[model samples]
Target: MLRQNLQQKLLQKLSPQQIQFIKLLQVPTVALDTRIKEELEENPALEDPSLMTADEPVSEYDDLNERDDYDSEAKEDTSTDEFNVEDYLQDDNTNDYSTSYNNGDDDEEKKETPIAIESTFFESLQEQLDLVPLSDTDFIVGKQIIGSLDDDGYLRRPITSMIDDLAFSQNVIVEEEDVHEMLKVIQSFDPPGIAASDLQECLTLQLKRKDVNNPIIKKAISIVEHHLDEFTRKHYDKLEKSVGLNSEELKEVVAEILRLNPKPGDSNQVTTKQLQIIPDFHISNNDGILILTLNSKNAPELRVSRSYMDMFDHYDKAAQKDKKLKEAVQFVKQKLDSAKWFIDAIKQRQQTLLKTMNAIMHYQYEYFLTADERKMRPMILKDIADKIGMDISTVSRVANSKYVQTEFGTFLLKSFFSEAIQTENGEEVSNKEVKKILEDCIGNEDKRRPLADEKLTEILKERGYNIARRTVAKYREQMNIPVARLRKEL
Candidate 1:
């Protein structure tokens, strides 16, 4: 026999409305319209004011707590395992869900925006295949090879695997030789490096497409084919010794190799990965006084559907006579409650966004005024959260998805927040400033003898940054800059 014990603990859980607010707060201005439209479609009780007509009477309800007396008693009984329709019919149980915040600005004349369409990477390859004259089987194999080419123009899948795939999927019992033949034809496409297995082959293919008789082209192809390891490791001395070239001659060879398209397919592939940034906040320097404004595109005027309210009234009247109509009342109440919470969430989203951003702007006021990385002070999520009296997670949610447009440029809000790096004089600065200096130092250094991490660290120490060599290396790697050897040229 075992004795049972009772456990008591304070547990916190996010309510449905709080969860809704958190999600809405994280949405950027660009996608917020789509999100609102989705809600409008899902819940008939919610609607944009611009869609409402003058003849339809607006929905109005007093405090849900004061109106719904049955709810208070229903909430007290926790013993029931049975389903309760009154649970949905309960008072929204929230006072902050503002019943009226529609500003009516969405009613202005809307204009159509044009969208651009273009052929994708695969479509372009298919169009090019049209020019080739091949039998049905060879064409099918060629199409398979084209489909196998990755966005970087490399055929990563092995011929054996593709042979199996073609046999299984297309019922084409072709050997490895057929696949290789089709692959060779594909490699001869518009992009010289297309269907290349790896970087060496890709570079060599591009080099062979150039003037083969040219001495520089011959050396470049030889280097890529024979000493790719040495080339990538920047073992220039070994290459110079092996290739029998002096400093100037070796430099020309390396330059020729550098001109080849490493990622040939990406050169023509249409992609929206780099979307046109739509900033959620705009910071304007008006006479050196920075002003921050939230994008109005995110703040749409929303209201409960008037006809839905009339429908609810009809249900309320019918429910008095018929018991079945109570379920309909519960449905109406749930939709209306959801619509109200959503509107309130949008309101909270705007307020929280402005509040958090205001705190950040003031925290880094000097940097905003000058648009100078040097002026930026080290800041983190906790810093802004503490200043705004909000949770760190909340600040993180805003920073993760929001973009701010400044006079200098539009930047992701997360980019502004960096860990503090203490300098020699007991002062702290943003690591971005250190990164900028590292960028500048690398930019001006002679490529023939690029500065190493140790040398860069010494330079930072000389500038009173007191950064360690390893830290400098970390920062260098973070900026996508390679080591001194990789950065070096002939």
Candidate 2:
């Protein structure tokens, strides 16, 4: 059983450097600066080229000088020679040698303190809580409850459970009613419906806060609470007959109901608006041609520090005379090498991102220009990989967490790629396009007698899209559109 086994097997494996390169390729230009700063702080080998000097000898620093081909302003310091890559390699096997580029250079020694802002949800909530006039116990309880509330601001756990947890964990005996009272106070906080027990309660709470005088709204709440089945099933005819309301009246009620805020907690989380998707690359339309420009603001100009490089050069040159100087040089070299890898990683990331996005833009040129779902053609990871001559996994990595802003809207890079479906006219269209058409058809349909999947399929065929009934049904469900019978209203 323990005998040496040899078998021919095909496998695809990536080294640490290769994996790092792929990751760096996807990072957009705007984020690249922060990423660089982080690297400078972590790696001693990395230096800021802005701080280079005439005294530093960079001739012997061959490895770093080669990277200078990208941004040549910064010179390498060739002073102390003792510090080298081998020392750091031997000192810590666990440390990623490439990740140590923390500080930039000796000249730019002092780092300006960053202005801290409210970044956490709880921090924002606590700040808002300070503005309120609740009792100390209530505030303490509220803070705990607020902390427990997720990004959506839903109090997921039961009050009794939380009360028990508090009593047991904090050794503070608190009644369930006290927790419940505090929760109600929190629910009244800026988010309007933060501490509701369930979806129905959440919606109802927000609706009740409104001073609108509409019996339809009152009935809508009743319907959502008790006759939710009737509302969801769209058994409007029966419900109308029972509730004594006609079709037009029901539509008016539905419209008002639609206007109510579903996620009140989201209203206060305004920081998301600040997160701008600074496109890593810009593609403009020229005279019947597409022009591409890499957004340079996002891409930083960086170089190794001259002082660091000079120290190493001097140490190396004077190693015969001074042993201490040689060790200092060795240390600086180790830090600088790390710094170089980080800078290299940053450069590599930009190239990969550009290459992948360019390929995608070309692949779905119509969709990028128009921003219409119908214009989107069927594309896959394999298709892009083939186009870019890169591995499918590499393409996938580029697609993941990457976004592109277009004239139409900002969308995740991966959303443009979908499987193709054949139309009755023997032409191919994206499944996404088909879904869009299906949604449009549903939105404009007669609620009195909603079209079934079979009917929808027939309609598509009439429009030159040859799709099966099951496919139509699948698309409907995927779009969150109900069944024909369920979709029918009064």
Candidate 3:
């Protein structure tokens, strides 16, 4: 049964424009160009102002308005369409999209950075595989083995699974012995340890290729082959006893083992890992004053298509208003509305990013003026959100994946925010400062006997900054510093 009741309730929802703004806000400057290009391809009513022809006038709506004035006799019949069309473009260049339509002298040319191309890990292995003369069946097995290797160059797939894949995909059946033989051949390829299934095998493969005649190489091979557990645990005393080598001999063996490539496949990743970081904001220190400017690339020149406006005008004044004409008019209306929403979203995105970065710059003014991180104060998403009169999620969206370039270096916007940790005197400081202190202490420590988290905590206590041992360990781990045992050297 259907039921109806009178009720009062409040519902909150984001409009289409708000949702678009949120998505565009989180996109970093590096990815924004591709996003805008995608929108241009999808929406016929939107066009890049820079792509406009030299002879074409920028705005056609002005002439259309004049044309409507001249057609006073027909204007009465087309009042609804005319009013809607005019209202759609009323905020034309005067309000929204001023970054593209206005902002003279600030506009600059956008240039793309070129990246160098290099061979992939699998491709390099394939070249070596090609040089090894084999039967067509063996060659297919080798290709399948190379294809199974991950980016780290490790073939984690079991032979049975690969055999099934070959049967299903390539319709080539091979025995387990054939696959193992091919794997051994590829493992012997250049940059030794390429196809080893595990780290022990990988290291053993690399060590075997070294000076076998040298006594130290033999001892190193023995340590890896038998006493690998002791070697990895850094139990130097036990390693010396197990391998029957004195301190100097064990040291030499350990040194020989240290030089092996753990991830041999990553050598080919040099070309593929070349990620470009385009900063969203640029902060400069001029005569003791900090100035923050958004990257001009973030402010692309986008506008509604003048041809689309003319087409709407033609459709609106057509004498024959058929079904097809009505459908065309509705389609054009949807496109125009979408274009307007997109342009307005871009404008709001610009304002929001500037406001957010401006607030962050002022809040950390001392840190920006002087590149010392100690000058940075504790700041969180709420701080900026409140200062900018926006939601915390909005501020978070602006900060996420965004970067800023200063004299010191380019840094992620998220780096500036940290939880407040109070000093003994009740003065609040950024956890970044604590992390920096931890990094410095670890950097200048005695590797023979590294400072444990407890000692680090005591040192902080002596300096009038009280924090627990666990907190110190947390900070140490955050900076990728190992514990006392792992940090010790021979």
Candidate 4:
């Protein structure tokens, strides 16, 4: 049955431009340099810096309307006395803009900063691959396997599929044994555990290669290889009975397992090349009060090219207006407009980042100053949006994938924002604070009898938090923590 009913609801949808603006708001100055280069490559009318800033005066568009009528001979005579664009152009200037199109001096000073080398994970892995000696066939197979690895350096593809791919795509009929051999060789590459087919295999491979001597690792490997189901399902008692290990022995094995690097690929990550988060705003202890500074790096100094401005004026003085000249004038204008827009976007990014972070710092002052996660207050995207006078999505973009470095440590921008829960005293508290307390409680609790969410809630209540068991569970999961039973010790 089809039925039509009258319905009225307010709709809030962002336009493409608005979405672009929001995305532009989050990009820092370093990325802006790339964006400028991209724009320059795509838009030819945009003048390069050198041509636009020449010292010699040229006819500009200022007289575009006034000099509409002129005899050809008379105009030619007047042009000799006209400003030569060359006198203004300095030989050292390499700006892409041509002389007639040059805007004044401001654009010259806004040259982009040179980018430094920041080798990524894949690049680093490839460098290691180069040092290993192998036959052409093995090298080819090895690289293909390496390429198939995930960020954690695990072989996500099945051996059978990789074998099939090698045969069909490369037109090389290699045995699965050959592929397996190459796989072993690649696995032996730096970042030891990479290329393993599964978690247990990955861990076992790393542990076997380690220099440490401990009975726990041997037992853990045995348990993982034979009774992985028991380990993963948290069937600790069953593992104890089947493996013939006592409670203390099982605990030691668990600790050893925890000590292993789940993502072995991270071991090779270069600290120097790592991307460090520099906050767009800084909150400092200023004479007993929090003082904020807009990370001035976000605000790039920019100005229009004077030579391009002169070109517009020069084009107007032509005795007989050439169609090419008219088109050139239009082209320069469009580039100027685009350049202006880019400058405006950069400014908007700075303002938006500052506004969003400022609102957050003010909202969570206690958490920032004291370095106590429990001191955090519940804050949703809407809460920040309301405070910063922007849409919720805008606030979300600023918070998403953004980090802030503080006096205590660096934290994800969104980490400070959490939903609220009521305390036993009927007081609203930030869920972040509750999670912190929960973590602290677990950290301090005796492992023999870990506190369940229900008991955790009671503990929180005793400490003045009136939270429910479900809420405690929710916070635990949000913090990526396991349940109390799984967190249990021998």
Candidate 5:
């Protein structure tokens, strides 16, 4: 014998529409257009309203509740394993698939902007290599060496490893001397230090390209080749004693070395092809009031296809209904439902973005108005979430990738949120203010005797910040500032 127990429990789950809305809400303005285009391609029933003619009649089943009777009847009749084609033959114009929103008369037509293409870094190098006269084997070996260069233009792989690669991959047997000669030729290519193995080689290669008769260039080469360690540690006195140079001559030698590129490949790097930032919101200070406007490019006008609705209407009134026709009508209905859900989700995403950003704008109103980062108040994701009556995760999704343009500058929304720190007077201030103070202190200190974390802590305490030495070090590292020892200069 077996016994069963009865229990009741509650569960929560996201509906398909809710999940879709969440994904759309997280997409920033720059990517929303591409997402919409993908949706358009995937669903034929979905269309851009601007592409439809002005005479296209509006859809009849625009309201979602209009299909309740047909849906209920379909659900009731579809329970059996067999289907009767005659069941859907009756004329039902009101049950046709349609969209909820109509195209506005004032909506302007959208046009796509074309992007220009540019050659990549490797392509430019290959072009230069073509001009070099060499045997086929030498050329292949040279190509392999160029291919082995990292984005920083350094050949990190060992010569022995490359020799094996050439023999195994290219079926070419060559000695270390051949590879070295080809490397020397490549290093002579444009952009002074194209195939250097390390920073020292890179600097030396560039100095050799300059006039060798110049005494300063020769001295700089000697310093880089010999006293590089001492020069890096700013052991200038040791370098002067070793190189037999006076103080003024040592300065000139150091200056020449500093002018050479440590990472030569960075100069030819194609950074101009980077994607431009598209700000999600624009905030303007009109006299004393701050106005927020979402970028219109994000919110596209989408609607159900009028021809699909008309076809569904025509099929509903057909006297001789077939299995194929019923299947076609069902497909149309499904597509129409998807289009309506997508349009609704886009609208909800717009509302949520505005709500979250409005709360942030007001929360940091003082900083935005004054264009002074120190004026920013202490705020966290929860504070805005509570203000706008949404979950912290929802607020975080909006802030993570979104940007806002103000009179001061365009800034990432997440950058405005900082933890609170109490001052000596028991007043709460943004940790950003403390970081700014620390940065100022380090910038003004005599680099010959840079301030340590303990000294920084004392300075903050004198200014009523009451911060600790460890906290000061943490903030300094967060700002990418090195320790006192690394910051010292001669």
Candidate 6:
């Protein structure tokens, strides 16, 4: 014999409508229009306000007022409750719903213009290669070498592997010497560093193209060729001893080396078509007060079709009840419900976006007003989420892809959030402030003797910012600034 025990539990889950709103909230303004267009195409019951006439009535089935007869027949046949057509035919006019913003702008005038295309880096190289004078085998080998180059214009593949490729793929047996000759020809192409195999080679190629008679140019080339390791490590003493140059002369050589392009292929790299960023919110500073406005393009005029509403009402009053008529009514009800749910989701998305952004704007109010990044306070997603009474995930979704235009400049919303760091006075400040101070210190330090992380930490402590040497190094790396040794000059 088996016994069963009674157990009860409660569970929470998101409905379809809630999930829909969450997805829409994460979509940026630039892509929201396309999303709405897709919904309009899929749902026949949905319609744009511009497509409907002004004088059109909300419902055509209003004349079919037979509620009393339908009720009495429902009572006689209790099974009719299983298919209650009256529930869907209620007098709710979704036609009155408008998705347009109050600012009044025509929807037909907004459109995206096509962008022009440009030639890629490889295509330009191939065109240049066509003009070179070479025999058929040499031309094929040269083309193979060019194809092996990466986006940075460096030939990362080994010559031995390329030789194998030529023998198997092209049915041509070529020696390492022949490949090297072709590579030399490619290195002499338009871009000074186009076919260099490494950073040292790239820099040497560029420096060789400069005035050969200049002592500084020759010294620079020698430094890149022989003393490259010492130069990179900022071992100025070693470089001066090896190159036989005085302090002032080494400075000139260092300056010349710094001017050469380390990555030559970057100059001819194909440019990508930049996407236009349409800010979702605009914050204007007026008389020291910041006012936020949502972008008008986000709000499009949308409505449920009046004809669909009228057809549902007509089916409800039909004297002859049939299977086909019931199916048709059910289909119309689904479409209508979906249309209403979508409109509601859009409204909810707008509200959530505004609420989250407003909280962030006010939280960083001082920074926005003065355009001083130092004024920004320590803030995180949790801070805004708590203020707006929403989940942290919701706040993150809103901040991740959204852009805002301010009196200062257009910035990504996510850039405003930063982790907190405590000062010597037990006060909390944004890490951005610490980074800004570090940037200034690095910028003003004597290039002859750059400050190391330990010294940087001491300086920061003197200014009331209590941070460790490791943390200072972390922040410096985040800013893409090299270590003191690499930053050292003459």
Per-residue lDDT of 1-490 in model 4, one digit per residue for the tens? 9999999999999775456576677665446556656765665434334344578443334433344554666456545744433333223233322232223354543554455566656777777778888788887787788878887778889888877887898876778899899888878776767788789898888778865466777888888789887787778999999989998899888777778778876666544544645555556776658876654445434434555645644565555678888798667666655655555565567667768888899898887778877788888999989887888878887787566767777667877777887866678888777777889988998877888888998998899977678888988897898887788766
Residue-by-residue lDDT tens digits, candidate 2, 311-395: 5544554526477765676677667766666556766665667788889988888766666789988999999999878889888
Candidates 4 and 6 compared: the better one by lDDT is 6
Backbone collisions counted per model: 0, 51, 0, 37, 0, 0
By lDDT, is 1 or 6 better?
6
lDDT of 6 by residue, 395-426 (tens): 99999999999877899999999999998788
Q: Which is the winner by lDDT between candidate 3 and candidate 4?
A: 3
TM-scores for all candidates: the values are: 0.85, 0.69, 0.89, 0.68, 0.83, 0.84
Model 4 Cα shift for residue 416 (angstroms): 3.4
* Ranking according to lDDT, highest score first: 3, 6, 1, 5, 4, 2
Worst 10 residues of 1 by lDDT: 95-104
**Cα TM-score of candidate 6:** 0.84
Question: Superposing all C-alpha atoms, what RMSD in Å does each candidate have to the true structure?
Answer: 6.0, 8.9, 3.3, 8.9, 6.1, 4.5
**Where is model 2 more than 4 Å wrong at Cα?**
1-16, 28-30, 49-195, 200-225, 267-276, 319-330, 366-375, 424-426, 477-490
Clash list (residue pairs), candidate 1: none
The reply for model 1, stretches above 4 Å from the true place, is 4-8, 52-116, 166-178, 272-276, 314-319
- In model 3, which regions exceed 4 Å deviation? 1-3, 55-62, 65-84, 88-109, 160-179, 270-274, 317-323
Per-candidate local distance difference test: 0.81, 0.68, 0.84, 0.70, 0.81, 0.83
Q: Candidate 6 — what's its lDDT?
A: 0.83
lDDT string, candidate 1, 1-490, tens digits: 9899999999999999998998888888777888989999999987776566898645454434345533444444422524333333333223222233222243441343445688877788898888899999998898888888889889999998888888999998888888888888888887788899999899988888889999988988889999999998999999999989898988999999888889999888877655656788889899978988777676676766555655564465442545568788778778877887887888788889989999999999999998889888899999999998999999999999999988999999999999899888988889999999999999999998999999999999999999888899999999999999888876
Please, what are the lDDT tens digits per residue for candidate 5 over residues 1-490? 9999999999999999999999998888888989989999999877776556999755544432244435455544544514333332223332221222222232441433455566556777888889999999889989999899998888999999999999999899999999999999889887887789888989999999999899989888899999899898788888889988988899899888878877766766767656767788889898978988777765666666665665565565455779999899788777767876787788788788889999999999888888887999999999999999999999999999899988878889999999999998999999999999999999999987899999999999999999889999999999999999778765
- Model 6: residues >4 Å from true position, as ranges? 1-6, 49-117, 273-275, 315-325, 424-426
